[model samples]
Target: MKEKKRILLSLFRKKSNMFLLGILFFLLFFMLVSVSIYNTSRDTISAIERTYGTSFSIGLTPDKNDMNQWEDRAIEGMDSPVRTYIGPNVDEAMVRRITEEVEGITDYEAGSRADVMLYEYELVPGYHAWSYNYFTTHEHHLPYDPEETKNMMYITYTYHTRNSCHFDQFYNGAFRLTQGRHITPDDAFKCIISENFAKRNHLKLGDTLKIDLHSLNVRAKYPIESLGSVETEIVGFFELTYQQTVTQYTEEIDILENWVITDNEAGRALDEIIGRPYYLSASQFFVENPAELDEVMEQVRQLDWIDWKYYELVKDDGLYSQAVKPLRTLKIIMAVCLVVIVTSGVLLLMLVILHSMKRRKREAGILMSLGITGKEIRKQFLGEHLALGLTAFFFALIVSLAVTPGIGNQIYGAVNKGGEQKVYTEKEIEAAIARGENSKVAEMSRNQRTGVEPPKELTTRVEVKTALLVFAMMLLIVYYSVNEAIKKTLKLEPIRVLSMIE
Candidate 1:
């Protein structure tokens, strides 16, 4: 053991050998730290990608001739048709077909708003004046009498869907369930109301809430004479996370406070009673992988069953793209760096060991002449590298612990700065809109976002397991290089080795 220790110590005493081996050790240590940081950064980006998925909204395409005009439809019992400006809505069959047949589609939800009246409760006040004052104040000409439409804006409306879980509002943090559960496909005649709405109405879970569907008759806008009434049980209550500030033109019907959410069964039941067209106001479909969204959309567009003239698919990936663009770019950069560093590290270490071994031929011959076995000489070389490597690893670990976090945080900070760092509230959104930014951002703010914002900064720390992994990898490289180098030298006779010039 003492002799082995002496041989290992003597190996490092040679300045040439020590310098080369020291450089190799430090290089290997740096490679290890780089790999560790790459892994941590890659994981952080992957998590964000998973959180924000790519999706698209399907809606009706507008007609060219309908520019700046509201489409009017005739009521059953009116002298003239009321101006019921309805946008093109997605067909239920089309939504089902696209979601079922499309390979990349992971989830979908269909939403529609119904004009309805609560049996006993009035709406939470909106920005618009009372319906009576609204007509007198705005000078709005309509086929319907102002007296008959006086209570029209005071009734409750429903944001109805089959599965509330997949709705963008609920998927994002905009709407948070305060009590009870979200209405699922399995739920029947179940509904969710805003916490403020529930509190104001003194309603709770399991309470029966009756809503009367509005009549489209021009003279009977507030009565339930046409479509009839449907009873629903309160299943959930949600609280808005941010203040829903009303802009100057915000109307009574546009306010969220008076809106209720109902399940698909309730919607179907309303359909059976109202006998209205089966059209969805909006439909969103999420892709399983963001990278494949374009291919999936192409496949959807090629379907023969869909009529392209009336329907259009608009990509709704603003939030996902904004959040993931920087992360993905960083991920790709780290991956490329990891590959380059690890590949070069292996090659450089091997070349250094082989070159150093060429100089050790005379030393090996003399050691063999002194009765040192080839195996013993090999062990000495292995011991020397292992000692230097371990020492370098310890120093590298200390420096990496102090350095990697700053590097990681710098990368994350740059990414955060490039993307939407914070979710803008309605007030902030209004400010952004006033700045002549994309008006679409305001609509997006009211709808979609990830449940949690991407982390503000990334933190990387070298763990014990990561150190062990680096140690194991270094050990394997050292062992392989030393064994291969010694094997070549041991192939020759000791006299031949001793006679050869260094």
Candidate 2:
């Protein structure tokens, strides 16, 4: 311990030398570590922004509210094939045209439904269709108030759909399969019922329910296209996690309650018996990436098969943008700053260390003349810089901890106009929504597919991995500087270093 102190004191006998070295090492290490922290934090912030900020949805929506947008743009003279049939539902041939014409779609699922009565007193509701209880209370259920709707018959049909769908009515809280398994798109005869409806009807899995398609048309004096009772096999029942409430002016009847879900073939069988060749209430089309939704929507609109009268593209971009905008701005600014800091820090550190090389070599020679072994002298020189470098590293770490988050937030805040991001701003995108010319709105961004938002603030921290990396880098640099000086001292005689006094 005593010898170590003597060697250290000998090296720093001149207070001026010690003061200068301390300042130099502190400044260099601080710059290096601080810049490293900036770069690391910037990358972390960028990843968070992209992963959560790119959320959005693009699909063939049944937004009847938006129909006016396209209806106004319809050019009667133009030659086009797509068309609508009953309100929101599109033609089967039109859907086939879309499958063959459009590009940039990742996956798709189309679905349709019908209304039917399970018993004389009951008009069972499925999807968004009204049940006997709700319609019975409304005066308009009969165009003229019927004396009593208790015995009235209504139309209800089984539903059929494709797979991997993000159907708004079904994806809300999502349903749990309470009995049996899911109905695949291939099944033509199997069906699944709501747990509540199953319990109410005293029906269990494997039970066969007969749905009549011609009863309503026959009673209304309209020609029944086909007449017969179709028996559907109940394969499963699902319990609702959350049922979606329909928006006003929406013609959709499927809202997840008492809604029977089946595959397309079975649904078509029911539709054919009721006279329509094909009807798709709505179909959702997924894009490969949410970030490219606007581009994809535009390409879809320009296709020859698209006729706005029947189908419109639907977007849910507003749902998540307001949640992630601020963090996105922060990530952008921090990334730029990180680049500047790292580039400047490396050059400055190299120049300063090379300039001090001669002085370090002189110190090594003097220590060797004092009966000190080569290893001990080397250890002493390395120890001195380690202490100074580590102290500066800690100071840099503290500054990074104190400044990174505030700096990122401040940069983002300034760009966002004093921390108050406005309500979602609309951008004129390249593509038109089925509503014809529609502006894309930017909200607090979120992950569109997962519907999850990112952390509120820019994430910054001196992680253990980062700290160790900085320490290892500084140690390596210090060792290189010391080793170069020692090489020169070993080549020179010890007596030659003592002759500097003369």
Candidate 3:
């Protein structure tokens, strides 16, 4: 034990050895921190991707002759369809057929709705006038009647109903369940509300709402009448926060309050009640493997009933790619950091070893006189540096475990805060109109619907593989530096060293 102590003291006493050990410790520390950061970033990117299912939209073009012109009327007074005439409208059979023929296709659904009035509830007194104006222009125009205007000025207002059709494949894909249940195939009169929409009208699960459809006849005294009523049992809700704020840039939209989701059964029911041709909305095909998307789309285009000129195939590739790009970027950055750190550490060790060799010229001369072989000297130096490198790496591993969680928390906070802007849903806008409380519905939609629980802090474990890798790298660097130092110090002849001392 005493001899071992003496050797340790002698080894550390060399200034160059001490400097080299310090550099190794710092190198290990930096590398560990960098790796932790990379891992945390990757996890964050993964979470975002998983929440938003990978999907893209296909745009349908209308014939130029069908475009509505406001030749003699104000832009607001011009009666035009929100969307120009596209295809004959997508149907459930077409959506299912496309999915069946495509390999790796998972699920598919489609929805369609015609113009209807969403009633608003009530609004605060201060902003009521502006709210009235907004709904009148953007939603449906409210007719002026001297006697009836006072009665209609209540909190609830009706806006023209826009038609929409949607088909969802399952609960797991692009849609995540936040609250209750998803709109299953069995759900006919049921609908899912957005978080933003729910908050705006103080709506909860199991609420029945009414939508009014207006006939185009100008002489009708009561322009609005209940077309169909939806008994919504909110099975689940979601934060369109990311989608609305990041993707659409429509910060004013409230998802839950404006948008409504119902399955095909309810759609068929609505068509029967309203007595209008339920226009086919957009059809979607969900696929498990993105690589097969192109082939599947081609087959869909070839279907006899599909209108080739008006219809286009849409895939979820763009959304998926965007979700994964961050993770890929983190991987690349980590690799570059690792290379730079290791190379710089090796160079630093070499410089320290070279300096030590110059300082230890006399020690080498004395050792030669004492009959130690150059090879033995080299072995001892290698052992000493190897031990120091291992110690530094172990310390770094300890420090990293404590540091990673704090970094992860900060990242989470930043993402959540950045997503706080209002996210409008078609239901929320409709709800505001239905309730006749359209005062700044956009501003009220920013609240998170599902209230996702905070993620647990990551407990970073020093992975055995990572530790082993670090150890091996440290050993290699120390071995090369110490071996070179020994070779230079011992190049002098033993006889020449002895003569110099005389």
Candidate 4:
């Protein structure tokens, strides 16, 4: 056994054989590393998609007709007919029906808004930048309440949802919770007031906020005249970052300072006061699997119970699609690269084995003539290639740890040259807000650029399982090539092999 092993080891001592081994080592190394990177990149992209890629929204799809599209009514003193787009209304029942029936929907946010008059507490004055200046320059009278002591009106937002983090103001960095926590679905009649408003009202966490429901305004058509008041416990305080507005309207109620966020029960109580049905102003849904978002949406559409006429299912996946466009392209490129590398590597390896076998044809014939079985001769060739392959595998794994990150990032950077929209993390947004960089956050939100940036650099490493998989595949190909080459060479008779070699 030792003598045979010595002969096998002696093959490596020859300069020519060493050169062949060197070539084989390099080929297998690149092949294994390439495979590892491809897999790692796939996993990274999937994680990004899962974290930031899936979002859906349910919105009103108003009737599209000449009469319903616009209400062309002339005011007694107006010069022209003012056209207004009257959208359809959404109800609590509809929100529940859609959410309950949608299979892939993992979570949703639903909320209502009501404008109310404050009788006891004074509201923080609304800051007007453009509108106030424009009215003053144009000598137009501002729309101030005739009675300064009269109750001030403000809008209150109410929510009952699994995740309140999806709120536009909170999500876009326009508002940050300064004290306490957000309103979750489990909460009932809890409130989150702005810091300025809380200070103005002399309120703190755990204080009760009493709002008069009778003072609710319905587009000035009529006052709510609701006979009751709803009181909510203030659980949170949020700081409203300064905002830059291009277009402005008159009214403190239009600003974020006067806005109050509360639970669904509080909102429902307001509706109950007026003896009116519960309605939802906004509802957002999310899916479990972003990759199958389209399929989930299709399932929602197929539900015959849903009247597509009154409702529209709007997908926020546009940004998701844009964000993942390059990722998807990178995935395809990786797949193609894997195919090309594997196919070429296998073919090249087969040729190398064949050439090496041809060189040792005389040796193989001599061994067979010495009563050595073809199986034993084939095993010797297998052992030689296996040794080289194993060495290359380990070396490739070690070196790949250093190179994969760079190569993976380069591939990602190349495909994402144009760059996707940048979405900030909660911490980054809060930091920007703290620095009074509200305009930056608002601009990002306004442009509908909600797609999160792909990973700055793809983190890739050759995992042990991945390395073993590639090594196993390499060994299989090497074994097949070596066995085939040996079979062809060993078929020749010992005399025939010697004669041909001579």
Candidate 5:
């Protein structure tokens, strides 16, 4: 034990050796942390891109009536004729039939909307005037409430609708429930609500709300008719980050809230109310590989039901590219930084070893004179440096692990502040259900909603394989540096080693 203590004391005595080892170790640790953080950031950004997908909107010029003849011609020319031109009034049955005939269609949802009134029960006791005002006036001014001034216990009303193409494309991808289940195919009359809407309305899951539809003669002060009353049970509520909430209102009509989400079943019901077909203005197609995108687009173009002039096939690859371009650029920068770090680490280690060799020359000569084998003397020197390198490496790794997460979070937050907060809501779904006026409101909501947020941060657990890899690298570097130091320090002529100076 005394001998071991002496050896250790001797090893650390050289300040240059200590510094060299620390630098190399720190470099490796920092590199590992940087790589890990960068990968995590890239993965997060990619996830956000995936959620948005490739979004493209289709606008028909002069409406579907103008393109009816063209659609008929395309369908008539097909080998197996199928109805291809889906307009704003297309029904669910038509969409289902088309899906059966299309080979490439994995899934689809039809978009439709109708103006419907949202009805909630207001129970105000005769004795509680304050409670009556609180429920009728204060709550009514909220965006979801249409009757803000009336004191007769008004239940705020808003519209709901569905955008068929948007629903089909983003159904499982972008829409996720924060508190409740999604509006499924079975939920024809059911609806989900946004967190904001639910909070404003004081609503919860399993609560039934009434919806009333308006007739075409909306201008008639009392022209709105309860064409059909549907009781929608609140199935889900989603949190809307500030980024997801729409801040601007461009249309002539004002919307209650900026966030909305819904399924196709509600859209179908609205279609029955309106005489025309409804199609989502936008569509998105996801491909397993980017290379296959062009082929998929080609297939969509050839479909008789699709109007190339009015609609366009969107590829997810473009969206992914746009989202990650900045990240990829950052990765390149990090790679350059890695190179600089490695170069500096190697140079610093080389200098320290060279200095040690120079300083230990006399000691080496005395050992040689005492008949110590040059190889054994060299082995001790190598061992000491290896020990120093290892010590520094471990210290650096500890520091890096603690620091990288914060650094990653800050970088992500700065670049993606606006994208992280917007969420979808059921009011938007209801707006989607209402065609014309309600449909316009839904579009306004989409436009005004907060920009999408960056993806959630990914936590990285250090893997055993990574630890092993780091260890191997450190060992290899230490071996090379120490071996080189040994050969230079020994400096003995093999033939003349017999002479003894001590």
Candidate 6:
């Protein structure tokens, strides 16, 4: 036992061996720490992707130009995208049919959208009697020239009728009512108006307001002067709950800020006034398991009620895909790196252990001769390497504290396949700024972005848990490397080993 202790001390005292092993230990420790950081970051990012993108939606647009494609026969776009439409009142019935037949469809909703020129007199108790177009011209700032907006028969707000999910300002948590309640199907002729519109016109709940309603498509067929008026009762007034993405410099013109919501019955009532066409709204199919999206879409295309020639299915998961791209890419690279590091670590350290055993052959044989068993000899070597590994682990942790952030950035950029950085040309930005266009700036800048959302830089710390995990992993690797050396050492005869040393 005493000799074994002496042998262990002497092996460590050899400065050259300790120095080389220290470098190796440092590198091994760095690789372990980097692996931890990237793994944690990757897992965190993956969770976020799953949370936000769990529901994938399918949208079918209507193709009104082709009227003859509605037959039950093999639809032209069955294998491809076909524009589709719903019966005038079958929106809810169709939603029920899809949710029942599609095995993976978790939720279903339908919606109708139409821009209405809404003109109301005495909208507020005491306000100026100025023309309604003044607000559209000055405040609303419709993305149209004045002449195009001229002879418009109504004061406008985009009217919406939600069937299943209300992805509107209120339902999406963009706003909450300051007074009154959200309009529901049970309520007749009820509406929800934005706070900005309420403030601009000083309107309130339960106010019976009459608005001249006209559809642009209808106006093309009939004279604008012939548009009819519809009356509605406001049930709710909602205030902006949070700051929204600015699409234009004119804040007052934001659609959500001045939007209006009505139940389907009331909206449809307005649509049918004065021989207006009953608009066929689109349905959004939601699948809880996005992986089954393709299967669900196939089933939907096979439905007898749907006409494929006019209805094209669109995926609504692009945001999720883009958001998950960078992190997923990095995770794959990290996994590959982990494999290479571990395999190479095993090979490289095996070489080092083999060389170390050559120098200590005589000592190992002496210990075996002196009644120290082979297991004890192996244990002695393992103990020595373990101490070295622990020492190296601390040093690597200290160094990583200073360099991890910069290293993380490099790893992110590398795995991003040369697309890590957002590409925005100065000329384009300047042109957008000069054009006084907010939306154009986003459009121009997004021409090239890291196809995936660039992951936030990982912040690393030399915490106790991380230290313990890395230390344990290092010891495991060291034990594996030394196992080969032990086999070679135990096979050596004392006389032969001594002769070789001499």
Q: What is the lDDT of residue 309 in candidate 2?
A: 55
In model 3, the runs with Cα more than 4 Å from the true position are 1-10, 47-83, 113-115, 118-181, 192-210, 215-259, 268-284, 287-340, 361-375, 407-462, 483-502
Q: Rate the local accuracy (lDDT) of all candidates.
A: 0.71, 0.54, 0.54, 0.67, 0.52, 0.60
Error of 4 at 109 (Å): 2.5
- Flag the better candidate by TM-score, 1 or 2: 1
Q: Estimate each model's TM-score.
A: 0.63, 0.45, 0.63, 0.68, 0.56, 0.68
Question: Which one wins on lDDT?
Answer: 1
- Model 2, 156-176: lDDT tens digits are 445677751344434422566
lDDT of 3 by residue, 1-502 (tens): 2334534865768666667768988898777766665665566555644543433334466556654521232223345534334335556665666667655556665666544334454322223334445555574655653333222222222111111122231222333446766666556566665566567678777876544333321213432344444333455564442343321212322222345565556556556664645555555555554445666666666678666676676664443454345345555666688789978888887888777766666666766777777876666656667777877887777876677567545544544343333456657766776887756554544443332222334334445666676777777777877777667457878776555542
Off by over 4 Å in 6: 3-8, 16-21, 58-67, 70-90, 100-106, 121-148, 151-190, 205-213, 219-226, 229-255, 274-282, 285-315, 336-347, 394-472, 500-502
On a 0 to 1 TM-score scale, where does candidate 6 land against the true structure? Answer: 0.68
Clashes of 1: 0
What value does the lDDT take at residue 183 in candidate 6?
58
Q: What is candidate 5's lDDT per residue for 1-502, written digit by digit as tens?
A: 2334535876767777656766777777866766666666556566655555533222344354565533532232235444344443334454465456645555544444454444343322121223444556554445333333232222222333333224432233333457877655455666665666676678788877565454421222322344555556777775433333332222212232323344555544555664444454333334443344466557656678755554444443443454455566556655676678767776777777776776766666766666777876766676776677677767767776777777666655565455432344546545555655765544544533223423454465344555566677677766777677667446655334323222
lDDT of 4 by residue, 1-502 (tens): 4436835674666455665566666666666566666776677667766765676666767765746656765533346766665545676566667779978888777887776654456665432334434444675454552232233333333444334566666764567899899888888888887888888889999999877654423323232343567888999898855442312222455556666788778888888886767668778777887877888778878889767777777777544455566777877887788788778877877887787777787777777788877778777778777877777667776777778778877878898886744444545655766898877745432323344445556666767787778878878988888887778677777778778775
lDDT of 2: 0.54
| Collision count for each candidate, in order | 0, 23, 53, 0, 49, 8
Cα lDDT of model 6 by residue, 1-502, tens digit: 5646765676668765676566566666667656766666666676655544444343444455656534333333244443443333335666668779878887665556655655552222111123334554575644454444443423345455553124434433446778777655466667777766777777777886555565453434223342576677987777665444332222222335555676666667777775545543645667766567778888877887776554556665554465567667767776777777767776777788788778888778788788778888888788777767777777777777677667776776665565444345657567778988877765543332212344456554445666677777787888887887778658777666677775
- CA RMSD per model (angstroms): 7.4, 11.6, 8.5, 7.5, 10.8, 7.9
Error of 3 at 199 (Å): 12
- Model 4, poorest ten-residue lDDT window? 242-251
